[model samples]
Target chain A: MEAFTQHTGKIVPLDRANVDTDQIIPKQFLKRVERTGFGQYLFYNWRFDTQGNPDPDFELNQEKYADGSILLSGANFGCGSSREHAPWALLDYGFRVVIAPSFADIFYNNCFKNGILPIRLPEETVNTLFQRVAQEITHTLTVDLEANKMEDHNGFSAEFKVEPYRRYCLLNGLDDIAVTLQKADKISSYEKNLPSYYQVQEKQNL
Target chain B: MKPRTLFEKVWDRHVIDQEEGKPATLYIDLHLVHEVTSPQAFEGLRLNGRKVRRPDLTVATMDHNVPTTNRNLPITDETSAKQMNTLAKNCKEFGIRLYDLDDPGQGIVHVIGPELGLTLPGKTIVCGDSHTSTHGAFGALAFGIGTSEVEHVLATQCLQQLKPQTMEVHVKGTLSPGVTAKDVILAIISEIGTDGATGTVIEYTGEAIRNMSMEERMTVCNMSIEAGARAGMVAPDETTFRYLENRTFVPKGEAFEQAKQLWRQLQTDEGASYDKRVVLDASNIAPQVTWGTSPGMGSAVTDRVPDPDSFQSDAERKSARRALEYMGLKPGTPMSEIPVDRVFIGSCTNSRLEDLRMAAQVVKHRKVAPGVRAMVVPGSQEVKKQAEAEGLHEIFLHAGFEWRESGCSMCLAMNDDVLSEGERCASTSNRNFEGRQGRGGRTHLVSPMMAAAAAVHGHFVDIRNWTFKD
Candidate 1:
């Protein structure tokens, strides 16, 4: 896991909502055990036509939105059946932040685990971002993970909130296992005493 | 402190230790694995020079990436072959039991756990796949975990979990004709926004619930995760006991009698209070269909897409607008008018013998539309064999529908089966996220019979008129 901090990246707009995990990375691409290289197959079905040609009409194919790192999407982004591949594909495809009006519960957690910041902003703020992306295709949005804030160069900014514990984990690149392992000494000590404790409890029950 | 519900009682009994300000350490009784998410966790263990600590507590099977059309051990796709090999190797090294392809016990993880009686009431179960909550229908506390969490449970047989608030959703009255458990859950999700049950444990109790079979209850709880609840449970009753009567892991003879005596007290008391309460009338629910990406963005088959302006709140309106635009559905268009190019009726959500029989009844004398590509993939080999034994497969084949092997085919397209780009499909699987079936492949989530009707009519069609006596 990558430690979270302030990230300034080019803004890429995936304006559509309900971007499910299966679409984020199709099931065919899930054959690889290694999480790497899924970026290439992200949106594989939509990026190509039946003739194996690139669909120029697709949102990602437009030249104006090329090289954008931030994805601005509508509400209920990532709302399908839970597949961690959705966030893996997004992060590998060079997206550092996903700004949406709302996100599915499982997909949102998966995003934080994979080092991608999923920010849930109010609908008005999301609409404003969409309008800005459409008006100035070259506009960029900056996300500060440390401050839990997202801002654009055009003076639009919003604060995103995350749980304190999850925020701590994301900022330090520590997952639940890493956090628990930090108490190895205490865990070992507890294990050593567990047998006697259970024995005493059994005696009391008798 | 509040009085304990069955959920609290189970959680308390399972707690091994508690660290201040951190998640409690609770022992897990069972751990389930599937091909899609286990390979990486096993790799992480190998890299760290660690071993599976409790192989006896763990079980593995293949589902998501397996092709429903083929049952060969060496799958045609190289990547899928490698994944299957890795799972087999991991299970062998760990001494864990595995139900590989062609095994009589092989099926969807959720389906097989109950069928084998591996999922018992009052146990804590964890799987790397969502919809693990389907086991909760048996009065167990089951939830999906991440890969790291899988490793944690593997090494320690315990998980660090924060206690969730409990909510009781009481449904009163009886379901009308043609209504099923799938419709009840869909109606519940639509009523309480998709996130209404977030961060809570929902205990479903009411007259309607007590009347359902174990399979019907599983279908209802399987989708509780869709409502954003950590898990959904029903108190184990005689119905549950009867379902597990002959299963392999269930208690035998005198032990069974003792277990039943204990299970009978799993319900809430009359004066018991919940942190939250929601009441639903089952009489109002209709056969539902999702017109948009989220399950909550659904309406009856006869209803039309609502204009965002009709929403009283700005947030509601914006969400409705986004769902409509992403779904490419025009406002005010009747859902019945939406055309479907394909129909799929198999997934952990509804792909049981009952589901296949219901779909077969609808398609028995009808032919699939000329332009429609319809398929029925059972959730397990056992289900497939049973359906064939009953001649349901022939009914589907004669109706011009493809009857294939068992796997999570087309549900999420982890296999080769998928919808072509820009085609619309009426699917029985959960979730209608944009491009969920395939890229630019529009999906409308419906019941199995509705899917069959759509297959016959080549669009979203109401099956009420085609109803056959059960």
Candidate 2:
């Protein structure tokens, strides 16, 4: 996990709501064991045609948004399925910040774990960003995690909310496993004195 | 002490460690796994040089990618075969129990979790699959986790989770005959759009939910993810206890009695308040079907497709327009008039024996409509055997429906069973997302009876109006 700080990048506007994980990275591409290299398969169905050629109509395929590291999407950006592959694909595809009105619970959490910053703004604010991106294909925004602010090239700036703990983790690149491993003593103690009703196959204890 | 909701009671009890600001590390009683998601997690554990912290508490099964047909033959898809092989090898190496393709108990992760009695009341459950909420019908705190969290749980038997706020969905009145739990959940989703329950765990209560059987309750809880809730739960009762009794993993004798005593108390306390409350009259919910890509784009069988322009929000209207375009339907077209090319009656959402029985009742003596390909893929080998013993498979096969072995089948289209381009299907699956069944496939989410009705009629039909010959 990489620490999230200030970064300015071209904006890619995906003007759809409830953009699910299946669309983010379809089931066919999920067969690989490694998390990297999903960038090529990200949005496989939508970005590619039946002939496997890149679809011209998709925003990401356009020249201006081709190198976008910031994504502005509609509400409920990561809705269906709890696949962390969604975030893996997005991060591998070079998206560092995703701004949406809201996000599905699991995807939002997965983004934090993977070093991608998912920012939730008002629906109208996101709509405005989408409109601005459409008006100017070169639209860029700078996301500052420490400041909890997003600033656009047109002097448009807005603040976003981040749960304090999540912000702390993001700023420090602290994954849950690292945080949990810190409390190893407490976990071991609790396991040792497990309640009788708490079923455990003692023969298989590690 | 505050009057706690069942979610709070179960969640608080499972917390092994908590910090002032970080997510709490809650102990997981059971962790479910399937072929598609577990491979990467197992790899992560290997990379970290970590053994499964609680192999006994975790269970694995091969679903999602196994072919529903030709089970005796080897899997031809190299990727799918490799995923299944990897899971089996990893389970063996990790010393975790697994119900492989040949196991009678092998089924959809969610279905087997309950049927085997591993998903007990008041315990916390986690699975890589979202429908793991199906276990919450037993009064368990269950939710879906990403593969990263899956690895975390496998290595530690605990998950660092932020506590979700609670919502209460109270369904008053009784369901009408021919209306099922699938219809009830679809109605709930329609009332509260897809993201209505975002950041919340929903506790379904009221007379309507209580009147359902354990399988029916599982059907309702299984689709909670469709409504953007982290999970959905129903308080356990005699129905749940009776369902779990004598199961392979459930306690017996005096231990069962003690467990039952604890389960009986798993309910919202008096005057407990929820962050959000939604009330629905179950009697008013009819046989439902989704007309769009999102589960929320559903209406009663009697209603026509909604006009995009009728929506107030631009986002809703745009999505509605896109959905209408994808579904190839006009705004005012009657749902019954929309023809279906295929009918699927299997998935974690509605592939249990109870669901099979309901569909079998509808197709008992009727033939599938001409040009419509209908199939019934049981959730597990056990479910297939039970349905066959009851002669349900004969009924389906005799009615022009293909009765196949258990796997995920067409629910996700990872296997051979999939909808062809421009094909429309009446599916008993949870998701209706674009290409969920296959690329360019349009899925209309419905209940088993409704899907059976569609197969017989070659279009959506209100099960209430369709008379069963049996």
Candidate 3:
């Protein structure tokens, strides 16, 4: 997996809350075990009309939001069933950063694992960013992972917080097992002691 | 220091070590594996050249990818067949025990665990599947972990985790007639926002909880994850002991006595303080149904969808509007007016025998609507066999409902069973997320009786009209 730091990208505002995992990537697309190639099918149900044509009425299909890579969404984004595919689809769809008032617990953790930055901002700050993106279709947001801050050209700025250890992991692309394996020598020593302990238990059973 | 609840007692007991300002190292007693999440973990182990440390503590079963309708020896779908084969190969290589599709014990991991008595009180259980919290009803500290965490546990039967704050949710008073434990939990999540229990381990207590059967308690605890809780638990008492008395894995003679004594101490002391307390009166709760995409966005069956402006906050109003638009529901429309094309009654949440009996009671005399297609899937093969013996299957089929085999069918369209695009279903499953039933399928989460009512009416209907003698 790639390390998640920060990036500046044009804002794509999906002004809705409770955007569920199934909507992020429909169940039909989950047929493939490999995580890649889900981006095209992301939001498959909503992006297209009955005839499989791109629904012009959908927010993401509008011309102004076309090339945007940062998604600004409402509260409780990525709610419902825990499918890691939600973040995989979003990351594959070129969303490096997802700014929302709040996010579902499972989806938020999955985003970090997949090298996607999920930033939780206060409702007021999120609304301001939404307004800015709504007003200026081509507006950009700059996210600085090193400083833990986000800002736009219009002087709108906010500080986002993440757990220090998770931040360290995201910065270095370390997963839970990778971190555990760092103490391989210690684990080896622990394994060496296991035989003697089990030998005593075996004698007791006998 | 304040006295701790049982949740804290179990959590503190399982802490093997801690990293400074990071999650603690938690010792795991049992680890369950299913086909979907284990392949990647096993692959990671292979890449690292490591063997499973404690294969004895691990158990594997195939559930998510197994076809419900056909019990053929070899599954037809190439991708699913490949995944199941990979799981079998990995388990064999790692020296782990596996219950494949044909095994008598083969069933949903949650169902089989309890029936076999593997989910003992005070044990720390971890699984890759989210509903692993279903084990918590036995007073165990069980929660879902990621595939990477699954690998970590395989290498060392432990987890590095942050301790969650504890919340004691008290449900007092007698439940009115027709209100079941499923309704009680739905009411709790509705009252407390879907995220209200975030970062907390909830303990369900009081007279109402103590009176619930083991199966009903499991139903309530199973969906605690849906409310954003790490896990939900109830103190193990005589009711729990009775349920496990004859199970295969339970200790016998002297060991049974010793275990029972320890289990009794798992309850919270009087005046134990929690980080938060939520109180609900059981008499007031009614059957609920999701009128929109999110579970928290639901109201009682009799109520209509609230106008967006009725929300206290602008953000909430916007959320309401967005859910309404996606669900194709109009503001101020009575929830009953919204029509349903299908009804599905099965899932880890409400697929027990009690749920089937509840639905069967409603469908016995009434026929399903002309245009509606309905299905009732048992959560396990054992449940299916038991229901058949009790003649519940006949009642469902007589009411024009399809009776099928087990495997998380239609609750999620992981296998062949699915709702056609643009179909709206009244489901007894936990989530009503957009496209959750199938591509472009709309779902309304309701109780089994309500689903049966909708199947008969061909629309959302109040289940209170169906009278039950007991």
Candidate 4:
């Protein structure tokens, strides 16, 4: 995971609510064994037409939001499925920050595990951002993890909240597996004294 | 002396390590794996050169990508065949047992867990699929995890989890005769918006819940993620133990008796409190059918399509309008008047033997309506075998419904059972998201009986009004 401290990027507004993981990356594209290369398939159904041509109607297809790194959307973004592929697709498609009023629990956690920063603001605040993005010719916001602040040049500034541990991990670019293995001794000890009733298999030792 | 909820009791017993500010590392009792999500995790483990900590605790199966038509035929889809083979190789290399496509116990991960008695009370379970909460029906702490966490659990037999708050949903009163567990869960999701229970674990209680069979309880707990809860649980009781008795994974003889004595105490304390409380009158919850793309958007089967203006918030109204447009529905049209192109009677949510029995009773000697294609894909091979032994397959086939082999067939449409574009389906699956069944496919989530009724009438119907000939 890349450390995320500060970045200023253009915004892409979806202007929709309850945008689910299926829409993020459909099940048809989930057959690949490797995680990378999902970017091309991100929002596959919505981004392309029945003929496999790029749909001009989708916001991401428009020239203005093309290559935008920050995703601005309505409330309840990433609402269905526990697929980490949602974040993988978003990050692979070059989205570093996603701002919504709220997010589904598993999707939010998956974003942190990957390098995508999911920011939740008040619904009113999100509405204001949407309006400003529509009005401005170019809207780019800078997200500073160390300061816990988000601000744009044209009088748009706000603070966000992330759990302390998560914030630290993002700032340090820490691999979760490495950090977790620090307490391997404790895991072994716990397993040794596990209650007999806790065994899940036929063999007791395993 | 604290009066702990069933969730807290389970959590306190699983913690292997914890810190004030960091997530606690909790031991995982069971880790269910499937082809679609496990390949990348296995690759990650290989890249890191780490071995599975406890392969015995983990199990794998080939679903989501297997051809549901025939186990003998070769999988024609190149990518899907590669993925299934990948899971098989990984399981064999990692020393984990996999219920291969030909295995009798092979099926949906959530379905096989309970039927085989692997989903015991008071254990922590994790899987790569969102419906893993189905195991929580046995008083277990089960929630879905991402592939990264899957790799993490495989390496340590533990996951670093943040403790979630608790909610108690009381379903008071008795369910009407025609109503089913799918209706109860759909009603709950509609009452609480999709994100209503985010960051919380719900403990279902009250008279109606206690009255539900183990299959029905699993049905309720399976859709907890639809309402944005991490997991849903029911306190273990005689019903839970009875379901477990004599199963393959459950203890035998005196050990079973001792385990039963411990499992009986896995309920919430009398004076325990919850972070939130929701109460629903089961008697009033009629058969539910989702009209929109989201599970939370639905009304009774007899109600008309909802108006966007009637929605509470601006976001809600906007979503409602978009859902109406995509679903090709008008505000004043009755739900019963909407035509369905397909009817699906199987998924992890409602594909058990009981669900099949209910649908068989409704469809016996009655043909599927003209212009509607109906199919029943049993949840597991065991479910299919049992259904056939009871002649349920004959009833469905006689009624013009296609009887198919097990795997997650049309529920996800990952296999060959996809619906054509703009086709509307009455299905028993948990999700109604856009393109979930297939590209441009519109799914109306309903119960087995409701779906059977829809197949007969070619449109949604109030099951309460229909009289069964049998």
Give the runs in model 3 whose Cα sits over 4 Å from its true position: A50-52, A57-67, A182-206, B468-470
Error of 1 at B185 (Å): 1.6
Query: How does residue B375 of candidate 3 score in lDDT?
Result: 95
Q: For residues B427-456, what per-residue lDDT tens digits would candidate 1 score against the true structure?
A: 998877666677677888888888988888
| Candidate 4, RMSD to the unseen true structure | 1.7
Q: What's the CA error at residue B408 for candidate 1, in Å? A: 0.9
Please write out the lDDT profile of model 3 over residues B252-286, one tens digit for every residue: 77778878898898999878888989999988887
Q: Give the TM-score (vs. native) of candidate 3.
A: 0.92
Docking class of 4: medium
> True interface contacts reproduced by each model, as a fraction?
0.23, 0.55, 0.24, 0.61
* Residue B358 alpha-carbon offset, candidate 2, angstroms: 0.5
The lDDT for every candidate, in the order shown, is 0.79, 0.89, 0.81, 0.91
Alpha carbon lDDT at B236, candidate 4 = 94
- The model with the greater lDDT, 1 or 4, is 4
lDDT of 1 by residue, A80-186 (tens): 55567778788888888888888766677777778888888888878888777778843887788788888877787889997666677789887566545555555
User: Relative to the unseen true structure, what is the C-alpha lDDT of residue B418 in candidate 1, on a scale of 0 to 100?
Assistant: 81
User: Sorted on DockQ, highest at the top, how do the candidates line up?
Assistant: 4, 2, 3, 1
Q: Across residues B1-470, which tens digit of lDDT does each residue of candidate 2 receive?
A: 89999999999888888878877889888888888778888898888788898887888899888988777899899988998999999988998888889878788888888877788999899999888888889899999999989999998888888899999999999999999999999999999999999999999999999999999999999998899999999999989989999886788889899889988888899988999999999989999999999999999999999999999999999999999999889999999899999999999999999999999999989999999999999998888999999999999999999999888889988888989889999999999999889999999999999999999989988899877796
For candidate 2, list the clashing residue pairs, or say none: none
Off by over 4 Å in 2: A192-206
